[model samples]
Target: MPVLRAPEVRRPGRGDPAVGHRQAAPPPDARAVRRRRGPDGRRAMSEIVFLFPGQGAQHPGMARELFGREPVFTEILEEFFELLDGEGKRLRDDWLTDDPAVPLDEGRRAQPLLFILGYALARTLETRGVRPGVLLGHSIGELAAAAFAGVFDLPAAARLMEARSLALDGSPSGGMLAVGATPEELTRFVDPPGRPGGVVVGAVNAPRQTVLAGPEPRLGEVERALEDAGTPGRRVPALQAFHSPAMAEAAEVFTAAFAKEELRRPSLRIQSTRTARAVRPDEATDPGFWAGQVAGAVLFWPALEALLAEGDFTLVEVGPGRRLSTPARRHPAVRSGRSTVIPMLPSTAEGTWEFWTAALDALDALP
Candidate 1:
């Protein structure tokens, strides 16, 4: 395969997000992609899996550069913000500016932004004729994946996300921490089943990485405990105790808030991180399952394992950051080159140049 180079930057007119940054050529359509043949005469990119990152992926200035530069992304995101009304504008302003009034870590800001970014990226890819064979998401990213898969229209998904944000606002105060230990290693730190306030394994990210969520002091205490146990934990940028009992009330509120939204069968396959498997046809339409995700542990590691067991895939990180891509790179299939990881966007606010290079590389690398 030939290495593609970024084209010369072209400054855009007024109100454009284009800062004269290098732009990649448009990607090939799905039919063209599928027809590609590798050196060995086998499909170079047989399966394309789009991985959407959940919370802890949001940051100020995320996708700001692409907002106006990419037409499809700009349109879909603007439409989504309109559906959200005033709160939507606030989110847009917060995301585009360096100084945001509300921190992105707060559930209200992070959840919707991440969802919208993921949704927009997926849609933009489709418009350029790049479609995924399977969709997987970390937490709130699943909502994005579902939206892209046609489980719910964009409007409904936006409504559901807004409802989720409001619900989280009413939930108990808490936080999350990423521990450098396996779920088995952290079993002693997790609360017993049905427990209400202590820390719990909120996510199983990889073989040796897990996330813990809990209410205030207990969560803080666990962070300290993990450090003392020789496995220090890094704080996940979040303000609510997601995937823990502390979100029970929030989950109920979220379900009730979007009770009337229509649910449809997904047109594409969705590998659910909450259940660590492919979402059943029934589960796809279950409001409870979607709502319950807010308070349920994310079984990301197992979900990835399930996908790997099925076949080799070119895992594309469709969202803003490398949160999902990093752990996925450690998977045996990827390490052995049976699969590959491609991040469609840059991970940080300052890597706008990197974004173009990465996107172009992805377009070229795709079969």
Candidate 2:
């Protein structure tokens, strides 16, 4: 049996007490000067974007601490679990346990739980006067973003998540491998000059971090190629190949499941990492666009760049671990001190409540 361990959590940086000590958060600059204030004197959300992470970020016990400690997060999350019926109970039971019968990376296990947690966190932030100006998500995280933006109500999103689980269940055995190479450098192995390979670049997360995906056998070939080139590659926890041609059939299954569901235009700004732009009204209503996400490459770095180009914005990673924050910090805007990244929970499961409060306090202290 695979003994599930705590998710790989990065240590909080030193000095910054809010959201793990990092560089003492710089004093709020110009952005804070023009910020709007609420009736009770709390800062209103402005120039802030809430980011959500997808599959690889999840682990057992994620958000367990927040469930009971924070009323808003607890109620909203419990409602999502209730919508899932028996499956919700099962996921909740496994989530709080140290060991799970199935791995958390499996789509069936990961997708629903992630969607619930991400949506709950967004709502939790809103109640604390941390409403976001925009929403962004990577891969499956996009669905959660849409839900928060009102593209789909919670029940509708849950149904789509269920549809996704069914589609993944029927997909071929495949997985993703994260390589420390640029997408251009990895292209040769994916489809060398004369020979065709199953692998495709699943995501270009950062300048040097890329994710490759395909059928298990083909992925093995790419992994061996990486070994030959003396490059490092790590397996991203997943049972089905997402964001690759191998997901074509699964995409069809997923689309058909939600063909008749109503999808509304987002009430707030929401960016798509898949398209690397703000989602359009037509795209919001198109079921195909959402379904195609299963077989589309995630242009996270490009999307983040595009957003940063518009202007500096505070990025809040509202999911488990620091998966999205890790890459966001590499962006020039963040590195140059123009933008900031705040994580709501610590990487480790142990100090989640403490970290959660600290992060909120930090946000309140901004400006």
Candidate 3:
């Protein structure tokens, strides 16, 4: 892991016009204008924001090490199960322990469990004195991010996530294919004249990576068209067609469920995948935004661009796998030298602690 230090803060050179003009102005005498200082007369600590990864990033044994090492992690998992039980869905206890053979990958178990693991990891990080100044989550990960940002209680998020997963479970069996081409190229494949079955572009992950979701049978036609157009692609293991028109019914169900729950403004900033722009805390609770997330394209590129525009950052993908981090690193903005992106689950290895510790070390080493 490489650690890059923030550049030294210095006054502008004497010849700089801005500096010369400021110098020419009368010195501020008001106490209110003075910089706030700590007890030791030093500036406040710098800030670090966290980005949480979504569903496709989950792995079988994510965050299991933390549960064994920390009682808080175990307690949080217990609370999550209790919440699910209240919703008439009891997640098996073995799921929390990270049993390698269990079929926890099913949407019903995977969504809530991923939320629990991410929450536990975030809590563990906080116990270690790492606090986020801002937060953003990708797709399903947004629910976890919302809880972390104080938009809703952990139990509320757990319940809502349960409802969300139930709504999506076996609704429509569709596939998500990742295409290696510009958005236009991918759109051409989906919107070809007289195409038999319909395929919708799900997410524009980067300049060259776009995900398409449609009926599994029609996937072959889309793939063939992409190949003929010089764009290579592969099918992702998503059970449902997320972020496409195919998910409209699921989105409607989720919207109704969300309407019954009271949502508060987030304590921290969040970026919307729908608008690819920064959303105010109040704006995040809007039902329309949540609904749009299901049937709209995830504008990840613009969201990433907005974060980078804030200046350099060290992005740690907090989730079960490295799917999001891989695409993020490949994005032009990320590759053009703005921030450091690392994944908490860095390996497909068996031991969970080793993987977590390695990721923690990488995060700590960031500037």
Candidate 4:
């Protein structure tokens, strides 16, 4: 009885497929620049720009609490999981609610569950008339954003998540260490010129926040070095080091699977983490573009810049965890500006009602 209302999977021949091949969009009106003052001589929210989080952000009893508490969220999530099951990928975790019986933190279920949570939450927001003018995700979060922007439907996205995770399963086991240091400072430790190890800058979240990925054993040395230098370095609980050269084989497998998918032109702007720009129609569909994501550094900082350039936008972190919001709120741009960054769900044990109300209140106060 769950509501299965996700948009139908559009095909090239069935829908307006030519839209993705269009040339780069013209720049926004110069008059559309950020307005320091509204008619009341105060700042105002002009648009909603969704920011999706990746793996490290997820925790047990996340969106599930929302499902158990909110009828709409529950229906949509259950329906989406049904679709994913139809695609031969099952939600190994009891994702519709926070069930203590099913362990939710397993690696095999992370990507798919996160995608469903994000996609379903977006759907819930739409029922309240809150649509994203721009969309961006943190690392693995981009996959969920892609689905939100019509790159693919839930079914195709489910397949991609499973295939990508399966491919990653074949890669050597590794881990990621989050450091409160710039990529420049961490360079020498990552795959240095003369080294037997293979570490690399996996994600560039901000000027000072970068994630280093490599064999778990090698990452220990890097962590110790950071500590010795008075820098903060903590391991992100993960079994496989993603977004590094260690993911080469996974990238190849994902590329082949991605090529077969039919990516639709987005109804709104969906920024790319690969190049830190709004994804063009062709580039959005290019298998090679998505392939690069596996082994390339996540340019989250630059992509955030691209999102802010589009006038005053409410950077809504529309997924579980504050991983993306934590840094974004501290980024010089957001910290200095009057812009707001609100998270849809808090990582704590608080129920989803307060957070959901917060989002509704924020959108209600928008210009």
For every model shown, the clashing-pair count is 0, 2, 0, 0
Off by over 4 Å in 1: 1-37, 40-43
Estimated TM-score for each candidate: 0.89, 0.87, 0.78, 0.82
Q: For residues 1-367, write the lDDT of model 1, one tens digit per residue.
A: 2222223334344233434434434222222334455777556656789999999988776777666566777778889989999988887777766677888889888899999889898887888777889999989999999999998898887788788878887888899999888888899988886698978999999998899999998898888888888888998999999999999999898888657888888999999999888999999888898899888999999999999988888888888878998899899988777777777766776655446444644565464
Please list the C-alpha lDDT of all candidates, in the order they appear. Answer: 0.81, 0.80, 0.64, 0.69
- Ranked by lDDT from best down, the candidates are 1, 2, 4, 3
| Candidate with the greatest TM-score versus the true structure | 1
Model 2 off-target regions past 4 Å?
A: 1-46, 192-197
Model 3 off-target regions past 4 Å?
A: 1-46, 86-90, 93-105, 192-197, 228-230, 331-338, 365-367
lDDT value for model 1: 0.81
Which of the two candidates, 1 or 4, achieves a greater lDDT against the reference?
1
TM-score of model number 2: 0.87
Error of model 4, residue 119, in angstroms: 1.1
Best by lDDT: 1
lDDT of candidate 2 over 1-367, digit per residue (tens): 3333333233332232434443333223323423434567655333989999998988767877666556777777677778888877777777767787667888888888888888899998898788798898999899889899988888887778778888898788999999988988887788532233378889989999999988878888889989988996999988888888888888999888768688899998888998899999999989999889998889888889899998878898899878998888888888776677888775668667666665776677654
Q: Put down candidate 3 lDDT per residue, 194-269, tens digits, no spaces.
A: 2334687777777777788776667678888878777768876567667766677778888887787778888777
